[model samples]
Target: MSAPLLQVNGLVKRFGGLVAVNGVDFSVAQGEIVGLLGPNGSGKTTVINLISGALPPTAGSVALQGQALTGLPAFRVARAGVARTFQLVRVLGSMDCVENVQAGLAFGTQNLPQRASRAQALKLLERVGMADFAHTTASELTYINQKRLELARALALRPRLLLLDEWLSGLNPSELVDGIALLRSLREEGITMLMVEHVMEAIRALCDRCVIMNAGSRIADGPPAAALAEPAVVRAYLGDDDA
Candidate 1:
């Protein structure tokens, strides 16, 4: 088979004496959505930070279509076709929605012209259900709308691989349903994704596979149902007796 779209091998991270991520390995195939599953403080976000260049690894490497991304700065990694959202919502609070997405298009891989970027930004906002708020300032948006704006901006990067860190968190039931549908649509449009998520419904609806981590190490990797059913994953999420 062709190489996986994104490959992460033996990924590790450390802060002085603390090992935030411990030798995790996983890959996301082109056109696939892989869920990164783990409870809070399980190193899932640390993995995302390492892969996206927000943090340098203590060891291991990350590659995109066989090109090394290890040690590159975040912008360079982004220019290499990887785009990500943070666990906490991040937006250009002072900018209007369209301008915020336009900023992404301006700084992303292609660096489109202003007019073209503006047009594409509107399209991205519409795709994420924010077209009506194009002129609204991001700071004024509700929390979920701000999340949608972030997604739109990330889409503005036109990335081949997307890393989403809890992008589905804090949504109500109906919004969660829409969020899953939106993610599925993005996958259908050919964006490979590795998402760190706790919402079981979204995972079941959107993931083609899952990689479960616990206390900085991987404990399961397989189809979502099978992986989540693994004894290690059960123990990590619940307790020893539950497993």
Candidate 2:
């Protein structure tokens, strides 16, 4: 593969006496939908927080498209071709759905006028299948549609790389199926994707490669079939078989 689109070398994060993330290295190459999976408290979200600049790294470096992003503010990091959707959906409760999307469109942009257009917001919502609820408030939307709205917001930046964090945290069987399909579609549209997911089935279906982390460090990395079945991964997350 050519050079990675995002390179995280020896990444570390510390909080006072606690070491939230240890020296971990990982990379996402161009056009790949990579899955980051682990048990709870395994530092998956912390890694996203570090990459998005929500928290500064205590050690190591993060490079995006061959450009270093050391100590840059979260908004600045986001403006630099990286966008992320949180596991928690945050929409303006008072505003209509389109307006909530408009808000995400303005996220990490210098020219708000260009991103906050009705046509563009509609297109974004349509892409995520939330166009029918475009006129409803955040509080009025069903839980599934709210999640879809958040996805539309993330795509508003025309991001080169999108980080999806727990996007399928809560959903019915149908919702999970549709959500996975929609996320897979982003790759077809030429968007590189990195996802932190819990659903084994979803990750297995959507990701071309999988990286497993444990205790703030890399335990395995390979294609989903190869990586997930690794003894270390199965032992650490999936639990080992009895002797």
Candidate 3:
């Protein structure tokens, strides 16, 4: 809708004659949260990779604010105002929380030393409620803290579109609530987000719209309540598993 801030059309990805994502299409608009849901191997991560430019699609089109992004590299994509986070929370194990976030900031900058200063890094940590953990070693932090660190890092890019993969995987109920609030605040700040998640409550609470993928293709697309109630969606991704 409204000429999506980021658009993926007929996206296809293959590996050794095996198709991972098959003609999938989706879009994320300015200030909206869209959920991408599917079971394991349903092509959620593959689709995110195509959008984030970590992997190229075999045939399809990706557009950012209506401009073609088909051939851009990952950094180029980030420069275009799209940021992605890994499902496993990629942080520097040796670096402190602040430093980990600073590395991410430097990524979208035009010019910066390979390393960032502690002050700059702390500022990012502050944004994610991690300022107190500024000096905490990544490996020393708990699982939820690491996820917050990942969010701080991603925010360093000041992206218009944020791609998140399984961001809620290991969070406790309270952590999920806090993380969802952070995402909502980002959306209010006009950041568009597309997330691939299995947490039903998070999806229902956070997303304005939903896209359900089955067999590498879209099977349902609509408001969360509507999509969740669809017959195909129940059978494929949200059925008895939710009940």
Top lDDT model: 1
Give the winner by TM-score. Answer: 1
Task: Name the weakest run of 10 consecutive residues (lDDT summed) in model 1.
Answer: 106-115
Stretches of candidate 1 exceeding 4 Å from the true structure: none
Q: Clashing pairs in model 1? A: none
On lDDT, the stronger of 2 and 3 is 2
**Structural similarity to truth (TM-score) of each candidate:** 0.98, 0.94, 0.92
Residue-wise C-alpha lDDT for candidate 1, range 1-243, written one tens digit per residue: 999999999998999999889999988899999999898999999999998999999999999999999999999998899999988899999999999999888768676787888889999999999999999999999999999999999998889999998899999999998999899899889899999999898999889999999989999999999999998988998999878
Q: Which residue ranges in model 2 land beyond 4 Å of their true spot?
A: 108-116, 238-243
How many residue pairs clash (N, CA or C atoms closer than 3 angstroms) in each of the candidate models, in the order given? 0, 0, 0
Clashes of 3: 0
Tens-digit lDDT track for model 2 on 65-123? 89998678988888898888887877688999788778777774645575447778899
lDDT against the true structure, per candidate, is 0.92, 0.86, 0.85
